[model samples]
Target: MSQTNDYPLSAVPQSARKGFWSTAFVLLGFTFFTSTMWAGGTLGTSFSFGELLWIILIGNLLLGSYAAGLAYVAYKTGLNSVLLGRYCFGEQGSKLADFVLGFTQIGWYAWGTATIAIILVKLLELPEAYTTPLMIVFGFGFCITAFIGYQALALLSKISVPAMLAFIGISIYQGSIDIGGLAQLSNISPTDSMPFAAAITMVFGTFVSGGTQATNWSRFAKSGRIAVVTTLLAFFIGNGLMVFVGAFGAMIYQQADIVDVLVAQGFILIAVLMLFANIWTTQDNTIYNFAAAGCNLLRTDKRRTITVVGAAIGTVLAVFGMYNMLIPFLILLGTFIPPIGAIIMADFWFKHRSNPPSLDKIKLPAFDACGLSAYAVGSAAAYFSPWIAPLVGIVVSASVYALLLYIRSAQPVAKPSAS
Candidate 1:
């Protein structure tokens, strides 16, 4: 029996690549998240059903394209985002990405841990005293699959993805029957107003952090085409389905989470099952993301150890009530996180021309002035932008990086002194 560290510090070897379905299921499970549904619920209250569809499609398309571009780079280089940061952000500079990305994933993990425990206690009529214990239990429990590494994640997704889809399908069918189908749904007007730009930003912000880190599994893809296509399917179609379900539930019952909607529909048993499956799938992926980033941060191959340690940190946060911090946390993620990915993309395409050298084969600088400067500029622009901040971040970061590159290239070279 061998342990799979999942090649945390290096490229995934060619022999270790995965086929399309294997890759797709892992990514699908990652994107099929409960929080995404919650984001959709917000949209559902602000727009008509038709408008919600357009918002969801357009947002997920942007998310999918971004993930696919990174996936292609991951496939070609056999490196995950944190590993790619070494090339893009430089040796010591990459740790900036490592901490930010890892911290965000831990936030998600803590939120999910606290969410499931709190929801279960309420739904099951358990004593409030059970909440903290449940958080402790689930926070550690969810990371078990991640600790086992990629095979366990894929195995769980293979089972959970289909099961979740079936459950969502059943819920949707029941909702339609209860509401008298599409015409009735169309007549249900929004109770609130939100600007179209804000709606788009919300939708895009919902999963941009996860999408940015999807290279964790995308690097295992058999080819660049496989990586790109699978990433699009997962982030676009799979994530779109989650959002639609959330919005549909919101429109019909004014409940955002599918689990809550199921409960409202008197599918108590089904609600419990969906809750576990939904949260578990995404939780494991989230912590797996944390583990991957942690590994790169510490420059270690001990992924399992980091998985346990990350779960512990997430549990502590959950105990202290990380669930209540979701909105502000998401806003922070939306403003600051997209710029990291944009800088990575700019580094890959413009700097490396999409062919970065092997990590171990080359000596890297402590920091890349261009990447760090571009990220700072991008983050600032996003933070201040009145429009869609994530999009603004992406555009500004890449543009600034390119401009900086041009300035550097234009500078005159000094002649060497005679030896």
Candidate 2:
């Protein structure tokens, strides 16, 4: 049975699906950040500027294409990624995905909030005690934006995106002049020679999860066409810029975040504005993602209430430095997320080969042993393997799942329950 595009879900309803530019800007806001620039710093010192650009561009394209697949399904069904997981992993089994996805978003929210406070302390030359209260203030403040949901995020993005771009533009101009123009900057020798393969993986690994989670916001897309084009633009242009900023900063000023370099260069006011704008765009989505995931996990419609509670939890975690400590773990876990998208893509394309199945019409297991088992194996391959961990995981998981489904299809078709 084919699913209706406008079927009412817990968080997203037909009335809430957004237009192309709104969804595109929101996704662009999510991708635009300072930390991404920081990741570029590492690549800058290691690889030639031309080499780094190619790596970042190609990496974002691959990650975008992978994410576009997930966004396509979300666009078709008006379902978030977690809800879509129910079809492949079983109804109850999806709760596990809900927890993981939601928990990671909370961690990111907390870390982002805490980083703001840290930046303030440094900028003002204040004591560490100021950090805690600052974290509380911004953390709760951003939570309010998220609790208000899409409207607030869209509004914030409208203001912040342009402000951020202008600030970055100024920094780029100043940095280029300081380095004696593009010709000199490009001619500079790399301080360290990072292997070409490692650099590519680093670029891909930087935000592989964000690319996969594109559906979180892309679900609101008016059409799959909008979803794909906008998502690729976010990854290819928006994310690619982040890498260039980081790499450029590192090569010129030994800094990754342009905001940090701005401060060091006596552009304190611009730095403050840039920092807040960069972090706010990412955190609003992070907290909203937690709320959306919470709605799915608890089977509730209290998105605002959950937002408040989740923000409080995240703020508390930030104060304790717990969220900061999880950075490496979170990056490692990102490898596993792409496999979920791959399995979902396989289930929809190979099995149905048309519109998505109606959740109410199709019979599903409480737990899909084959899907879960494949997830574990794929995660292991991503963790243990050296090459293109995400690709490896996707191929392995999809192959395993397709094979299992093929075997199942060979068996007698069980009738769905009437009740």
Candidate 3:
């Protein structure tokens, strides 16, 4: 299919025929080289051996299943998936969905820019004063690439993915030789007490909110089977690779920063390449989604909005002190993500009974106060609950929405008079 200047909103058959391997590679690149892994690096620095193992086992099981399940839903529901929230949130409720997704994308873009700045400063031994300017330059560069849209982003992924994978392979091979054996590396851990649950949350949180962006990529898949296969492959392989490298780093180096660990391992070139590649993949998607959300809310040209807003926000965050607050920012993403997934799944699967109406013919069903109430309650429950906020939020919201639908259906309708 030929590339177009306009943003393609619908899934055209011509665009959907990308080969399975190509799709798989793109998915793998995106998932593997994300900030979540960097966040996991921090987690690995704190968690004990047994606890980290438990987190990897349980968190991967749960989150990987969720990613596959949501991809299946997207396959069935199609392009206007987010708009299906009309059944629960009213006609305007979808805007709230857009805002949540958009705001998070902006945050991710800012974080990516900061990560690039951090990598460059450490790599070159630059002073603190140079970090902000470098970050702004990186941010602007990412915004320009993202403003070019999906095809450009896909090409970027193709180039970056192989280079990153090769670098990772080289690092692992060298690190294993230096450290004696793989078994010795596998047995080692951070030697500190970090909650297993927190580790699990970080793994799940990294990709859970990604459901919103699934359609953006999957819409181009040739079939539902392709989407399912590609998504499962990406989530499992990508996350597995991240944890594997994290474990290796933990076993060999005691440093808290992953870049430092890479440099110490004599893989400084690979370190810089991986860092840049990872940040670019993440920033592209982040800016793309932010622009899409703006178009949805304002009915404006995506190119204009994305370029202007992405550059403006990216520049501001790079200039200000936002990147310095990574943990708090990530925790905030963890908090609200489950609710959006809950609402999307509930609206598309249950209320519509697995058949969403045409996008052009969309109807705003009566506002489900019960559903909205459940979201509020669920969000609160997530905050208060000690062990499983994500699970609680999903259950509460779904149950509330289901109950409301049942009640409304049970009511008898008035009969019309015959002339």
**Backbone clash count, each prediction separately:** 0, 1, 0
lDDT of 2 by residue, 1-419 (tens): 11221222433555677888888878888989766776688889998878887888877777778778788888887777778888788888888778877877787778888888998898879998899999999889887777777777878888888888898889988887888887787797899886665666666666666776667778888777998888888887888899899898898889887878898678999998888889999888888788877887887767778888888988998998953463364346457777787888888787778476678788989999877877888778877777777677888888888888898889997899999
Candidate 3, residue 408: the lDDT equals 75
Q: Which scores higher on lDDT, 1 or 3? A: 1
Candidate 3: list runs displaced more than 4 Å: 1-17, 186-189, 256-258, 301-304, 365-371, 414-419
- For TM-score, the strongest prediction is 1
Off by over 4 Å in 1: 1-3
The per-residue C-alpha lDDT of model 2 at residue 299 equals 75
Task: Please give the lDDT score at residue 268 for candidate 3.
Answer: 77
Q: Between 1 and 2, whose TM-score is larger?
A: 1
Give RMSD to native, each candidate. Answer: 1.4, 3.8, 2.9
lDDT tens string, model 3, 1-419? 23443343433344445556666666676676446655666666676555666776666566566666566666665553344444567656666766777777777777778878877897989998898888878888886666776667778888987877787787777777777876674566565555656666666666665654655566556677887788777776676567656655665675434455668887777777777887787677667767766666664554545556776796687667667776666666656767766766776777777777755676564455655666677778776767755666667777777777778789898899898
Clashing pairs in 1: none
**Positional deviation of residue 60's Cα in model 1 after best superposition, in angstroms:** 0.8
The C-alpha lDDT values of all candidates are 0.90, 0.79, 0.66
- Candidate 3: clashing pairs of residues: none
* Model 1 worst lDDT run, 10 consecutive residues: 1-10
- Which ten residues in a row are the worst by lDDT in model 3? 1-10
- State residue 141's C-alpha deviation in candidate 1, in Å: 0.5
